[model samples]
Target chain A: MNGPYVAVIGAGQATAEQERVAERVGELLAEAGAVLVSGGRGGVMLASCRGAHRRGGLTLGLLPGPDRAEGNPFLTVTVPTGMGELRNGLVARTADGVIAVGGGWGTLSEIGFAMRLGRPLIAVGSWTVEGPAREPSYPTADTAEAAVSWVLRQLG
Target chain B: MNGPYVAVIGAGQATAEQERVAERVGELLAEAGAVLVSGGRGGVMLASCRGAHRRGGLTLGLLPGPDRAEGNPFLTVTVPTGMGELRNGLVARTADGVIAVGGGWGTLSEIGFAMRLGRPLIAVGSWTVEGPAREPSYPTADTAEAAVSWVLRQLG
Candidate 1:
């Protein structure tokens, strides 16, 4: 089923735990019949794409470079942005919601853009962003199960 | 003097202290006879552009959208990329060096891209990037004076 398409933003180079969480998150989302979207590089992005693809779920990668060669091996469909990492904004902005795993600045930038766009942002072992006291900065979850469930709830 | 062009990446929604640092960085870079480049939006980018313009230094803003209206007030020239944040890569890649002030994720992503391309990255109260132990993740500067000096030294 072509349900809510969610984007997962993380670093191309990630720690083992981060990669593990990303794969689990992707698997859960695919099992739920959700379409997967990622930066289409490596680390969490690659893991998510692979998880979705293996489960027969549709996957899309919004690649930054002009060529698809830079994309990860798991992407089912790659859209060459030729924009570079600024494509982070496009990945987050176009998604219905976002799941941020352990990441570096690139992931943070995507989070910033998603937050600014008022998209549903769920951080799983990711950055702790604090905003004004009155405003909401988004939510954080402890595990992949919690993150994917939250995304589904948001789509529902 | 057209000595060099340095990019300053930081948060669009910045604190007074962050903005002050960014402005000072711009001023110092301009005083050194170097051109300033930024995202050309609000917060630190706008502050930097303003500082450069007030100092009679050339400033370029790589704006995201198709129009120049989104650019900061002090920009001498705004090149609309229409590539959205993807222009961040262009800004970082084209600059002689990058000075990162207090910023959010967008700034972080630029840092990531710049580092991957082996551009000298100077962090001023910004991200703590970690890479291979043998390679310098990036250098951190305590003040705008130090940051600008470092960029100049790199160019020299």
Candidate 2:
């Protein structure tokens, strides 16, 4: 059985932190016995996969197009949603919780979708602050260890 | 006047790379005198905004919820789309070209939306790989420079 599933959304076009963050997130998800989900690319998503794989956690990459291989190597389950960017909402909505790292337009869309769908999100590490009526904004942690710890508290 | 209006979509969470990559991309856009569009939170979008602002570029953040102030500090223009996650497609389609950085579900959705809408996307870093004619795949890139360069070539 899956422990907990979390969806991570961010920029694929990034090079430095994007990739590093994804890898760290992936590792955290694995260690936490959680499944990591991403758009299935490089940078943040790939980094997430690397983290998950290193810890032997399950990783899922939802592809925007027909090809499944477009996902990162760490993905254990790859869902090819031939939907296109329209699927961004679906992906965000499908997750139990979400985390927004540094983002672009794509990441913002997911944040919007998650909020609209009323899912719990942990905006950590200099991300956005939560507004009123939603869950209280958790502490912003710089390292993945701190971020994952916050996620566990929220899940609990 | 704007050179070419483009939208960047990806995760909002942060890692070490977020600031640098966002700044670099913003610099490039500013050099071209283009308007930078994003989800308007933190991480890459904020970095992008900071970069654009430094060079006196027009930065726009398409916010999801009601308050535009919830956007990044660097945004010169903030469009509060009460549309929520569904509006992600609008952001994707709104741009002439879409760029992907390190991202998750929301980014994938944008890519999916773009693909379905037949829009152009240039993926960089490891976030994901986008091709107009095929299904979406996530390919990894080690650096932001490589990802951005690949995107430029793909756009050409």
Candidate 3:
């Protein structure tokens, strides 16, 4: 399947659990030739960036404010959207699929955006999204391998 | 100062370093009686939430998609903007000053949006916006207290 950019929406600061998950997910995305897109900050986004960078993947950070320099160091390209949390939907739509790790309202919003845009979405521990039909959202393994496997199936 | 509701923008997954900063910032915001606005996810925003929540201050989350259920538990009010990342600027603009913590492109975009709107901005923890301003960009601080202090001065 053609590579797709997947947006991972979550907190800027990551817990140890999140770091483990991000590392695994990063490897999966890199191997599958998918780009990881995030808010370009710390927390889950940065953990994911570190994972992706280690795996030789391309990581894009969609910064909300105006400065490109504020992005996480791992980000290969930083898009200073000059937007705010409102742009969260754009970040979700830009991706073919979405992976939401443990997050708060921002991650929740991105998941909602993914559903609104009809993008395939996968949730790891503590993050979930549903379709209009009231179908329960699919829950994936916390590890990167399981998450990527599910994403590949959706793409297929 | 009018007790401005400053938007703290960043990713959800914060690192250890970020958590320490977040804790400090939370205390400062609480003491300053400033309302914290964010994407309403985790990370720096949540840390702000924890700080503000303790003092019973206001916390607003402008989510990306439609479901308020996806918002952070700490969010006292959740606005479903449904605009995605494109609305990032709107979030930044809703506040009088913007406080960015360890961020990425999304945070960068928030900074950019703040700059474009000519609003005062504060950066903490190496946010790229801290660099010497080519124009009338605001100042930067190593910690959240200093950033909030700087923002209050700007608002004044």
Candidate 4:
């Protein structure tokens, strides 16, 4: 994580499995000394940020609103987008690679952005993508550790 | 178009059918006195801008890069975002309604943003969007005329 930037794109209101995955991913990213970026909301975002902050990792949140106060408290930097869900593209652009946990429209959008930008992406669990291309567009992992490892390998 | 603003979100490089749809949507928006907005690159964006410009309608392009020169010549005003594809959210936020003429990662992101913001969206082609609450999220149309009409009707 020291030389690379990896973003964790996941559900804002995560499921139990997604929450666990995001937290572990955050902790791993922090341990690797990589900076973490997210949408700065609840659910997976909150969990990831909390994990990263606990591990003493730097975290940045791209908030949809105009106020930094709207960001999750775990974030070290708050980028006020005032662009709502559109900020997902920024998350993709900012990351050298990305780890997607669970699935949702927002996460899907981030995945699409990452693919379009030619950034590496690792998907955890089902993509929840409708009518996705049959062949895997990116790497898929079953656990947060595997996802983070794949992203790091891609970065390396 | 004079009274309202409509954004046409689609692929940067589109197929023949999509080009026709975008052009007609732009022309129809102009004829209905609604301003045309787009990402302002090529393919659908170019066709729509060309259509609106030919009809003496105002056209605005929200470009992702820093250079206004990268925008299509058809645009009346080229807004240089320097935010890469992140500018798609601005395209969605600026419009009163949006017409999605084709499918791509960029276009899908716009659709998600529009839906989250509760803005009216008319999908002119298949988007492969998942988990969109089947009822009252957005309308789907097969033709440019129908799409523009639906947006205008909603605006009215």
Q: How accurate locally, in lDDT, is each candidate?
A: 0.81, 0.67, 0.72, 0.82
Model 3 vs. true fold: TM? 0.51
Range of the 10 consecutive residues with the lowest summed lDDT in candidate 1 chain A: A128-137
Which whole-number lDDT from 0 to 100 does residue A14 have in model 1?
Answer: 78
Write model 4 residue lDDT over B1-156, tens digit each, in one string: 348889998888788898998998888888887889899899899999989988988999999999999999899999899988888778888999989887576776777667656678888774655442223446789899899988998999
Q: After superposition, how far is residue B147 of candidate 3 from its true place, in Å?
A: 36
TM-score-sorted candidate list, best first:
4, 1, 3, 2
What clash pairs does model 1 have? Answer: A86-B85, A86-B86, A108-B105, A109-B105, A109-B106
By DockQ: ranked, best first: 4, 1, 2, 3
Q: For all the predictions, what are the DockQ values?
A: 0.21, 0.07, 0.05, 0.31
Number of the top-ranking candidate, with TM-score as the measure: 4
lDDT of 1 by residue, A99-156 (tens): 9987765676677677656678898777654332224566889899999999899888
Clashes of each: 5, 72, 68, 3
* DockQ, candidate no. 2: 0.07
Number of the candidate with higher DockQ, 2 or 3: 2
Over A61-105, each residue of candidate 2 has an lDDT whose tens digit, in order, gives: 888888887887878999888876656776776677787666555
Model 2 residue A124 CA deviation in Å: 4.2
Residue B151, model 1: lDDT of 87
Per-model fnat list: 0.17, 0.11, 0.08, 0.32
**Candidate 1 clash figure, as a count:** 5
Q: What would the per-residue lDDT of candidate 3 be over residues B2-40, giving only the tens digit for each residue?
A: 677778776677777776676567667767877777887
